[model samples]
Target: MAAPPCDSSAHRAFDFWLGEWNVHTPDGKLAGTNRIVSEYNGCVLHERYDTGRGYSGESLNTYDAGRKVWHQTWVDTTGTLLLLEGGLRNGSMVLEGQTTGADAKLTRHRITWTPNSDGSVRQLWESSEGNGPWSVAFDGRYSRK
Candidate 1:
C-alpha cells in the first residue's frame, strides 16, 4: 500500500518541534511553556503556548503543497492575528509577515525556529518598521519537558 498523503518528507520538516517544551530566555528565566502536536494525519501541527501569567497563544502550521511553503496562523490573547509563510532555510524554519499596528505603522515580523544539536530548539522573533533596522522582539530556547 502506498503511504499516506501527509507522510511525505516535506510535511515532516517541522517534526523536530513536536513535543512538550519548557521555554526559557537566554538568561535562563522561564518564559513560558509550549506544547506542539502533530494532527490531521500529520498534515498539521498545532501549538499552544502559555506564559503562566494570563498570556497565551495558539497557532496552526501546515505545509502548502501548491505554494511549496510552510504557513502559520497565530492568534493571541491580545487579539493579535499573524499570518506568516515561508519554508525550511538553512536548517531552520523561517517565516515572515507584515502587520499594521494600531498607530497605522507597518511592521514586519520574522521568526525563525532552529533545532540545536543538544536537542533543544531556539526561537527568535524580530521586527522592523517600514524598512528600518530589524530588532529582536523575543528570543527563547525550548527544551523538552
Candidate 2:
C-alpha cells in the first residue's frame, strides 16, 4: 500500500535539516557528523549521528498529529536517551523537556535549531535547574556535507 501524504506545512517544518552534514563546535572544532533522512512519506525524520570517536546515536523525529507537536527520541551507544517535544516557532524548531542530572536534580532542557541564510544550521542546547538561569550545554553549527 502507498504511504499517506505528508504535504502539510507542519510535516515539512524540518525539511531544511534534511541532508548529510558535518557538525562543528562554536570554536570551529569538529564535533560530529549527521545524516538526516525523511521516511514514511515524510512523516518521520531519521537521524544518524557519529562523533568520529566511536560514539554514535540515532534519533527518530516525527510530528504527532494528535498532539500537534513535533517529537524526537534519541538513543546513543553510551546508553543516553533523550526525549524532546515541541514545534516550529518563529522559523526555528524549539524543543523543550525535563531530565534528571547526575546530581539527581531535575533540569529543564531546551534545544533550538535555526536554519541560516547560507544553508547551514545552528543548534543551541541549554539547561536550567529550578528557577536558575539557563546555561549552554551545547552549541554546534551544521554544514552540509
Candidate 3:
C-alpha cells in the first residue's frame, strides 16, 4: 500500500522546524521567540514569531503539490503582508518575494532557514531595493527554548 498524499515526504520537508524556539542574534542577544506547529495532517506549517518588544508576525506555509513549490504568506504587526514562494535550495528553505514600501519603492525580500548540525536553526533575511544590492536585514539563530 502507498502512503497518503499528505503523508508524503515532500509534505514533511519542513518538519525540522516544528518547535518552540528562542531566537537570538549572532552576537548572542535575544532577538525573539518563535513557535511553529504542524497542522492539517502535515499539509501546513504555521509559524508565530514575537520579539516581546511590540513587533511580531505570523506566517502560513504550505507545499504546493501541483506546482511543486513551497509558498508562504507573512503578516506582521506593522501592517505588512508578504507572499513568498520557493523550495529547498542547498539544504535551506529559501523563500523570496517583493512588496512596495510606504515610499512606493519596490523591495525584494529573501529569507532562508537552515538547520544546523548542532540542532539549531539559522534564519537569514536579505533585502534589496529595485534590483540593487542585497543586504542582510536580519540574521538570527534559533534553539529550543
Candidate 4:
C-alpha cells in the first residue's frame, strides 16, 4: 500500500524547532539541552534530551495517517517509555498521553510548541499528577544558530 499523506501542518509546524536548545524548569532552574533533528524522510522528528540530573532520553515523533494526528514515543536510558498523542492547535502542537500497565503510573503530559516572530521557538511540557493541576515541567528554547 502507498503511504498516506500527512495533511496536518504538524509535520512542518515544528520545523522551526529543528535545532539545539537550552532547557529550563518553570522555577528558572537550568535543566540542560534539547536537540531535535528532522529525519528528512517523512513527517518524523527525532529528539534527544540531556537533563541536569545526568539523565538522558530519546524520542521519536511522527504523523499518524490513520488518526490524522501527530504522536510521539519517548524512551529513556532507564527503560521508561511513554506514548503521547495529540494534535496542533493555535500554532501550537499539543500532545497528551497516559501510562497504565505492570510498570506504569497514571501520569498525564501535554507538550506545546510555539514559534516566535523573531525566529525563536518555545516548547513547553506540562504534566498533571492526576485530574488535579497542571505544572510546567520542561521549557525548551530554540534559536536558529
Candidate 5:
C-alpha cells in the first residue's frame, strides 16, 4: 500500500514559506538564517534556525484538520519552548499563544508571517503583558537563499 497525498488546500496555506532563507531585520541587518522543509508527505513543516551567535532553534508546524487551525511547537537551545496556534487570516499566517515567563509572569505572544510579492517573507513577533500594548520582539524578513 502507498500513502495518500496531503494536498488539501489548508495544508498548503503555509507552503509559501517552504524554502531556505536568509532572515534579516527590517532595517536589513542580518539576524539569522532558516530552512523550512515539508515532511511526512506535506503534513508537517520543519524549520531550522541559526543565529550565528551560538543560538539555534527548531519548530514543527502542522495543520490540524479537526481544529481547522495551524499549530507550531518551537524549542531553542536556550531551553525556551513556545507553542502557538492559529489559522491563516487576511493572507497571513498568524499564531498566538500565552505562556508564563521565567519571572513567573504571564505573557501573550503573537507572530505573523506574510508573503511578499518579491518572493520574500516577513515575520513579525510581538508580545504583550496583562492587556498591555503589544510590542515587537522580533521583526525579520526571510529572503530566499
Candidate 6:
C-alpha cells in the first residue's frame, strides 16, 4: 500500500530551531543571527533575519493538510519575496517554488536539518535560479541557547 499522508505537524521538525540562532559559512565566518517563532497552532513558522550585510527578511511557513506539504514564503525589507513549496524526505525538508516579480525567476529552496555531535542543529539553504545553477544561500547554526 502507499504511504499514509504526511502529518502537517511533521513540519514541526524545525520547531527545535525556534529561538535565537547564529548563521555561519562553511568556512567558519560569522553571517548573522535570527529569532524564530511558531504561530497559528504550530502551523506557521515565523523567522526574522538580520544579516550583517544590512539585509533583513521575514520568513513564514505553513503546512497544507490538503496537499500534505509545507509552503514557505519569504519577504525581505528590500521588497524581495520568494515562495517555496515542497515536502519532507528522508531526514530533510525540501521546498521549491518561484519568485514573484517583474523579472519572474524560478527559485528552488532545499533545506535540511543535520544534528551535530554537540546536539546542535544545522539548517542549510540551497537555491537555484531559472534552473540554471544551484548555490548556497544561507546556513544557520542553532544551539538552543
Using lDDT, give the best candidate's number.
1
Task: Report the lDDT of model 2 for residue 103.
Answer: 82
* TM-scores of the models, in the order given: 0.98, 0.92, 0.96, 0.78, 0.95, 0.76
TM-score of 1: 0.98
lDDT of 5: 0.94
lDDT of 3 by residue, 45-73 (tens): 99999999999999999999999899999
Taken over the whole model, the C-alpha lDDT of each candidate is: 0.96, 0.92, 0.93, 0.76, 0.94, 0.72
1-145 in candidate 1: lDDT tens per residue? 9999888888999999999999999999999999999999999999999999999999999999887899999999999999999989999999999999899999999999999999999999999999999999999999999
lDDT of 2 by residue, 71-115 (tens): 999889988778999999899999988877678888888999999
lDDT of 6 by residue, 10-104 (tens): 75665655777777667777677778897765667898888768888989887787777778788987897778787666656667765645766
lDDT score of residue 103 within candidate 3:
91
lDDT of 3 at 1: 92
Q: What would the C-alpha RMSD of candidate 4 be, to one decimal place?
A: 3.4
When 2 and 5 are scored with lDDT, the better candidate is 5
lDDT of 2: 0.92
lDDT tens readout by residue for model 5, 1-145 = 6545567899899999999999999788999999999999889999999999999999999999888999999999989889999989999999999888888999999999999999999999999996899999999999999
lDDT at position 62, candidate 5: 95
Off by more than 4 A, model 2:
1-3
Full candidate order by TM-score, most accurate first = 1, 3, 5, 2, 4, 6
lDDT of 4: 0.76
